[model samples]
Target: MRILESDGSIVDIFAIYWFGDETYFYGMPKNYGGLQAYKADEVTVIDNKIDFKTVFFSNDDAKSVHHWALIEESLLDDLLELDETAYKRFLDILKSEGQLDDNFY
Candidate 1:
């Protein structure tokens, strides 16, 4: 048996597998057309509300369209804790493909 975050929440971040930047990530409601990307030290973690006005940039530079959704911290912890085994396995796949780092919280 397997557990999941959502239909697109976890499915969207497979950057390396999709021939995209390993450092990039996707937000909720995962629409591939408006995917997110990052390079270098651009990825960040915040403990506040998702500022709808906030913008993220990638190697592409500037944005024509943006797609993101915020997942609450407590909810995030619950997901990780309850689904530890399956989550780790998914992370391992990313690690093997060089898309994720050990910094998962």
Candidate 2:
């Protein structure tokens, strides 16, 4: 899977697979979130790019988790080709929101 940045850059190489009744988003645990059923359809491919609409949850303690409503592919290509700064920013955002998995990064 790939994440497209605002500048149309792609980075963060990952894979998507199905196991039993759930869809797993592998790689960089903090940036990964598993989806099931209807949520899995959120990630779609369009124009050879990927898009996502994410829903976030937070508590008074400032911890949060986000569930992305995958959208049609955008213009992003290789997930590993993203600018280093951008990738770090992405990871930071995920970490700050407590959305990152323990195994991420």
**lDDT of the candidates, in the order given:** 0.32, 0.37
**TM-score quality measure for candidate 1:** 0.25
Candidate 2: misplaced stretches above 4 Å? 1-26, 29-78, 101-105
Residue-wise C-alpha lDDT for candidate 1, range 1-105, written one tens digit per residue: 011232322423322112243333343212222223433134343221322322333455322212211132123233224455434444454356544345543
What is the number of residue pairs that collide in model 1?
0
Which candidate number has the best lDDT?
Answer: 2
Tens-place lDDT digits, model 2, residues 1-105: 444434453333233445455553433323333221222344432233223334443444432222241212221122334444544555555556555554566
Worst 10 residues of 1 by lDDT: 65-74
lDDT for model 1 comes to 0.32
